[model samples]
Target chain A: MLPGMTTRGYHHGDLRRALLDAAVQAIEESGPAALSLRDLARRAGVSHAAPAHHFGDKAGLLTALAVEGYDRLADELGGAGDDLLEVGVAYVRFAVDHRAHFEVMFQPDLYRGDDAEVRAARDRAHAVLRGGLAALPAAAPDRDALAAWSIVHGFATLWLAGALPPEAGRDPEQTARAVIRRLFE
Target chain B: MLPGMTTRGYHHGDLRRALLDAAVQAIEESGPAALSLRDLARRAGVSHAAPAHHFGDKAGLLTALAVEGYDRLADELGGAGDDLLEVGVAYVRFAVDHRAHFEVMFQPDLYRGDDAEVRAARDRAHAVLRGGLAALPAAAPDRDALAAWSIVHGFATLWLAGALPPEAGRDPEQTARAVIRRLFE
Candidate 1:
């Protein structure tokens, strides 16, 4: 062990969170293909078996990350006041800021979607969007919700992939607001 | 060899197209992960190595598939007549009808983005949309084009992921039309 490294212990109280943070870093650096529990453990400076004890397997770690992602997304969008368009902007902002989490969360085949925590978190994030849409006029709440979700999610996903044009120089939040405004115009 | 199967036959003139068709079927059935060149060859009733003669590797095969997808999308959208909303509706129709192609085309990491054929195909598809947008008044063409592309592409992507609720029961084409109509309203 390196000097000042505390490796003479196995009772890592925050091992689960540490492993998840390491996984996010790994995904950001190398994409999802390079994720491995052993590699994550090594990066976390814990024994190779430590991550297994906390997460059970690679999928479990990803599920935890995704669950956390949903909660974070919900919190961010929920704080955007009662303006539906602002909530849409917040949704895009969350995706841009947390690209790793957003990417893994949507790829259903990468993690067990039925994981209780993951499902609950996803529902919470979804409910935040639903609530925002509910505040819209009652003529077509469902349509507006789907449209708003699609525009923000699409913009964020495309921007992160570097698929947008250079001329699209506006910040993500601005672009999102502009697009969402057009939805109700 | 199995009965009626000739190993040394020189009749693979259409093997390239056949392989692409089989790949589309495979992708639709199992998504991008389960696609295999050997399996595609088997489905095409050709020798295992025959696909290699047309596509250098699996990525090459996918590149060709993406190219075809872009061409088909351009054709569908271009044929939507003068109604921009109808064009958006056709975009969603393409996604629903050609789920396999839509899935592979968007995954930038999976295909050779720099390939000349792929670039040309993508540009052609983009031109179709650009041309459609050019027909609108000159005042706000740039923002209008971006919004139009984002809405249609985003809606199709979300719908295919089954992210929308069934109670939103509005068909994708109908929903796309409504969203696009709002852009001009």
Candidate 2:
């Protein structure tokens, strides 16, 4: 092992995590469209080939981000309490706090859809949201789940896009709770 | 005018419309972030500089698209009949049919948010939705409007993102009506 610039001395496991972290910052700075593995590699202070080796290409890196995003979303939604209203608010909170992941996760065209990891991660997140719908009173479970997801997802998407009016406010969790409360009523 | 290859003979108004049409098709084929004026010019059979002259940059073109989108949304929402349910259904239809426009309109970072045309157009669409909410029984006009917008907007966004489960089915307008009907119930 040589000095700071030694290529062979760096751990592969650490490099992958560093690249993923750099991706989040890059996405936050510029929307996911401008994400480049080369930039991530440069930001991580690794050789250019390191990122390409770990993620293949732009879509591959985004798929990784999306997989991480879905898993995180599942963890948050499943742990946000069993109350439907609370779950709905938690959905919004996750989106706001994880804007980079949320944005990339939804734009399927931006990532590799065939990756098994992505599919499984997405399933986990869906299960969490769908499970929360069991508490709702609609005669049709599917339609009710769609309704519950849409209200929260739509609010989150609109909020992130800055499409909502000023009165909607910046407190995603609080505002989401108020709007979602109407559904239960 | 000398045949089809001359950029000098291309009318400014005609080129502008052609570029806008190209953008819609391009956005539909690839998500909005991948849109390039140069690619649009090649698609439109105009000089490379023609698009830049009209829209200035990538953001300028998207701003135009956003403006057109909002104005069109206002028209559809206002004319979807006096019933809020019908209006909500129409909103879903617009989103599905005009997916390209709808996608760009909401993502303000993709365009010039402060552009006068965008602001005015957005206000027109907002007024139509806000006016529709007045018929509801809520003491809080703004919150109710936000709720209505969130449900319909969320449903549309999910449908477009393919985020809703297969049980929600392939017909967006139908699923949207069923889900949105929850609010009216």
Candidate 3:
């Protein structure tokens, strides 16, 4: 078990958190498609059935993770305030910093996107993104929002996938700021 | 076997294409990380060793697929005729039309991105996109190119991930045209 995780603390509320941390580790080491609940149980140093007892199944566990991811994203974007450029930079930073969460969050096939908590958290994140867009002129703000979202999301996704060329540089946030400035400036 | 695929045609120059087709099918059904040489061979209706014989390993097979993806993308973008907006639209269309290939191509961890053939094909695609950017003003063209690429790539990826809101509308090419216009206009 990772330090701070406990196999015997299920009822005390630490086990669920431990299992999620283990799941993140597993996903970072290997992508989420290979994730199995049984493996998570072993990683958490709990009973074979312990993961199922907490999450019900793999999708359930992933749903919880996705919700957490969105909540984190919402917080990060919210912290960037109303500067659209800063919000875009913050979005890229979130993807690079919380890669495991970012990976699982976008892949809806791995989790229940319709789950109430997931939708709530996702909407919160979306609202934060949209709030930054409110500063733009009202001429087709929806399309502007979509364009803004796509550029930042693309930069983040490409950076994470290692698809960008070497000249794109190492710092995602700084690179994203430059790319985003081309559009909104 | 999919129509036109054969179980007995190993050396007639058709098996390689047939196996790649099966791999695309398998990846469409499941994501790339779950892909295996043995499973692909089974799906191809060939000896379990056939996939390894043709591609050497799973990464080799995915590398081949990524090369094909880039080639096809280069062709499509090249055909878009120097208009950056059209090239962006074509990029989105390619992603929507070739989901399996698109999914595998971007996830560089699943394949040998540095392979000579992969690099050549990917460069061809990148050059096509860059050619479209040549029509813009010379000031900060690199950042402009990066922004344009990010918006289109991000839109296509988000569309594939089903992460876009419903009001964003269907017809990826049309929606992409509007989104890409926001940056270049």
Candidate 4:
């Protein structure tokens, strides 16, 4: 380990948090596909077996990340108030701001998609998104919800992939709002 | 090499096609991130150096895959005719049917997004999508196009991730048509 890079005196929770933070950084640099528990432990300045011990394996670690992602997304969406447009903007913003989490959260093949924590957290986020649809016209609320979700999710995915044309603009939230407006209003 | 696995009598184009076919199968089993030229050659029953000679590296091979993906997508979308709804349904169908290509094409970071072939092929696909929008109302074509792309892309992504709720149903093209109708109707 490098000088000053030590896990000395770190409590259990702090160590876990540090490892998770290191994972996010590593994922941002590479991607979820390249992740390994041993590498995460090395980055966290812990024992080689530390990550595996804590998270069980790479998929386990990614499962934790997905759970955190869904919770954070729920918080962001809930905080955006009950307006569907603003919620859509917030969804895009969350995707841009938390890119690593966003990447891992959507790729279920990379982690334990059936984990109970993930399901509950995902449901929380979904409920918040559903709450936003209350402002839409009552005709076909389920269809409207799917449309709203699809537009924002698509804009975020396209933005992250750099697949959008130049006219799509640099501002994720602004561009997402405009795209989402086509579905409503 | 395994028994019955031989590259004898294979022409240049045939070998390349065989490698690409092997790559698609591998990606379907694992993903783009796990792809390696050596493994593809092994799967194709060619000499270890053959894949390197043909594609240069994993990214090069994936770039070729992305180009092929865009071309295939263009063909599928074009066959949908001038109807935007049909085009959207076609987009989802392409994603479901060509899972490996769809996965690699959208994740631009996995390959050379600026490759001339990729750009040209992607433009062809984009043109088909744009053509479908001619059926939409004339208020804001550009915004409408973005919305149309987002909805279809998003639905396809969610379907692949298994992120959509149970109510979304299992039939991709059918579900996509319903989700898309919310935007224009």
| Model 3 lDDT per residue over A116-139, tens place | 999999999999999999987758
TM-score of 4: 0.95
**Candidate 2 residues A103-171, lDDT tens each?**
999888899866899999999888888888877666888888888888999899899888877798878
If both were scored by lDDT, which would come out higher, candidate 2 or candidate 4?
4
DockQ for every model comes to 0.42, 0.79, 0.79, 0.75
Q: What is the lDDT of residue A181 in candidate 2?
A: 82
Candidate 3 CAPRI grade:
medium
Best by lDDT: 3
State candidate 3's TM-score.
0.95
By summed lDDT, the worst window of 10 consecutive residues in model 4 chain B runs over B1-10
Give one digit per residue, the lDDT tens place, for model 1 in B110-162.
Answer: 67878898788888878777877766774556666778888888888777766
Model 3: how far residue A80 lies from native, Å: 0.9
* lDDT over C-alpha atoms for residue B89 of model 3: 95
Compute the lDDT for candidate 1: 0.79
DockQ for candidate 2: 0.79
Q: Model 3, B1-185: lDDT tens per residue?
A: 55554558455458898899999999998899999998998898888988887899999999999999999999999999999989999999999999999999999998999999999999999999999999977588778888988999999999989999998998888999999999755
On the 0 to 100 scale, the lDDT of residue B118 in model 3 is 96
Clashing pairs in 2: A154-B154
Candidate rank order under TM-score:
4, 3, 2, 1
Q: lDDT rank, highest first?
A: 3, 4, 2, 1
Off by more than 4 A, model 3: A1-11, B1-7
